[model samples]
Target: CSSTRKVPSTEGKVAFNFIQINDVYEIAPLEGGKTGGMARVAYISKKLKSENPNSFLVMAGDFLSPSVYNSLKVEGQRVRGKQMVEAMNAAGTDIAIFGNHEFDIAENELQQRINEASFTWVSSNAFHKKGNSQQAFAKTDRPVSEPLPPYFFRDIKSVDGMQVRVGFFGIVLPFNKANYVIYTDPLETAERLYNTIKDSCDLVVAITHQSMEDDIRLAERLPNLALIMGGHEHDMRKQLVGNVWILKAHANARTVFITNVVYDRGSKKIEVMPKLLEVSEKIPSDSLTQVVVDKWNRISSENFASIGFDASAIVLEKGEPLDGRESEVRSRSTNLTRLVVKAMEWAAPEADLAIVNSGSIRVDDILTAPVTQYDFLRTLPFGGGLVEVEMKGALLRRILTSGEENRGIGGFLQYSEKISGNRDKGWDINGLPIQDSVSYRVVLTDFLLTGGEANLNYLTETNPLIT
Candidate 1:
């Protein structure tokens, strides 16, 4: 085994590999089994580890929630990311961090998943809320609950006998404000943790679940750092901010970023090379990990059967791919988004128009034909029902403006064919300008009525302008 290899000195230099995937939700291959499978990722990680003993598989977060399996109940208890933890364990995942969606499940369920994980978790800014006090989230598998560490470090020796200490710290975006979570300032937490561990380790890395802007700010704040593996964005991206490299892979294990690092001990210089690899049918699945994935697939099917739906039943078959990719749906209206809005309008025939937030559509893949009931479940895992609201045009216009400004983010709205117009030109419904005195009947997701959407908190049903 590569782990048993002897180390030989190579004139004060060390090399290692980091295989990173972020914002993964599904364990099976998506898009007609052509792309994305945790088992395929496992094959890549295992292959890399066989080539280099210092290889580490890192998940940058968002694996637990917003998945079809997460909504399923098995044996009277919610699956709640149990399948993901089991697959990751079998895949040999080494390290991970928390994403905003990790808090989507109940606090107890989140703790249970943490306890089930075999990998190390590092979180620098997030904490468990204990009344007024804050504490690290803990694993309860042991007799005593062990708080997860703020940072993680590992000592690695190259085949040339050059020893290096690598350190990692993780910070999540404070987007999801779960009652049990307390989030500190990510920048402050990162700087403090880096200062604390930098001296002890030759290299330090960050695993973050935040916006690209936030990641850039972090890179600028700590220009000496070598790399930042990020999540929350469903697209793959890489940017060099000063000497540091920021990398993110496509969501749902559709792709992975492999970062190769070489450090010169004498000169204290680090070199990073990042490669984005597609996880497709071309790559073979790891047998052991596939077994775990298949088990979960069976559970998911069984749950669907119990709930009176055929998991494998075809919902629709389209020749062209439905564009539900995150970047596309959040920024502009796509066919899939239009279809969803039309469905809402059909469900509420009396409503003047229908609107849905881009975030409501979670499957970030361009789904191909033969879309199954399972695909629909994955697309809208949260499964909120449509709600009709009566609100004055003045309030409706304000809500539309808020959604317009939220472009590129989840809060952006997808409107039915009846609505059109832009900020400068003004919004219109069915070719007529919105009149402030008119009361419009609008259909939207029930979640939005609670004023939970970004920058639209005043849109609740209790507002004077809404009924």
Candidate 2:
């Protein structure tokens, strides 16, 4: 899982290194301790810094929400990404941007997490909304609140007394659309920032939380960009558009990218080289960061114990890997989704069928055998009770159709195996076709019944079709 590459000697070049990771949710090692731990990342970061003093650890975004720890209560208040910020602080993260998921918490809680961060934050397109006004998101933890800047510049000196200035800007996709946030056009904002900072810096980099297509478009629009470190996709990707390179690492720090840049003073040219490094058992965890990670793990275990659950107890031992990956669950039914829906049906035996939104499956990793209670908790972090309801078949058809249309998103439905068919072919309950006049019993997550799912607001308990 590790690759070795040689960087041409930095004899007369101004050289620096960047350790990049994105879409990370878990601070501890994942997949039964086989890969990815913030303490291990900390170890890597320290090693990189020792090799090159100008080394910087950068995170593209999406670290705050959709985590089991975020759902737990600590000292009577929701943890709400507090553990993530603490882990990152200890991991030596130098720069970060706001991912859409960062707004999943309330504004106050987000501000608290921001205030706790020791690194710099930059965003070019996201803003804070207040009534009819919009402004830059700021850190209020200090007496004098510090507003996050649109971009930042870091000046580094090579070993031989040569200096280079690197400018960085960040932008996130406006997908979340939290009421307190206003998102501007990403391309426009990136172009504007690049033009403003180009003359002052030797090279410019972009940290983004967006789709690969959008990242390619951004690269095409700003051909002068030296590099783009991006997130929002769980898999690792590397591509070149024009002269710029876009790099993304696997989610949960399963892998990371180490980018090396060399600036030639006489030629006025910049050369970029990037390497992929797997975070596995080969890399040792940093002693200091492991202490912080262990602290949170202990807290999580205690909370689970109080609820009559042993976090480490093995729940199942299947040889086949369970697919809880975000891309797969949202687009189609997988073994993990089927297991969830089956469990729902078992909970409500009287119900003819059961359904749950793919968004409920939050773990974006391939779970191996010997799955533990902690794994299930991570999979369904925003836990909800199952609700059995009796509704007209006509209403059921509409719900299924809506879920079909919501493909490739969290709101897409994963239902029991007893139900089948698409809109064109029509739906069936068990082996029989659905009849509009028939009243069918169904089990569903409380979130969907409360009309919280996307494009299914009509499925609420107050709807006339549901009794």
Number of the predicted model whose TM-score against the real structure is largest? 1
Write model 2 residue lDDT over 162-216, tens digit each, in one string.
6777899999998776889999999999999999999988899999999899999
Candidate 1 CA-lDDT value: 0.89
lDDT of each residue in 93-171, candidate 1, tens digit only: 9999999989999999999999999999988899999899999999988999889889877887766666788888999
Q: Please, what is the whole-model Cα lDDT of each candidate in the order they appear?
A: 0.89, 0.89
Tell me the TM-score of each prediction against the true structure. 0.97, 0.89
Clashing pairs in 2: none
- Deviation (Å) of 39 in candidate 2: 0.9
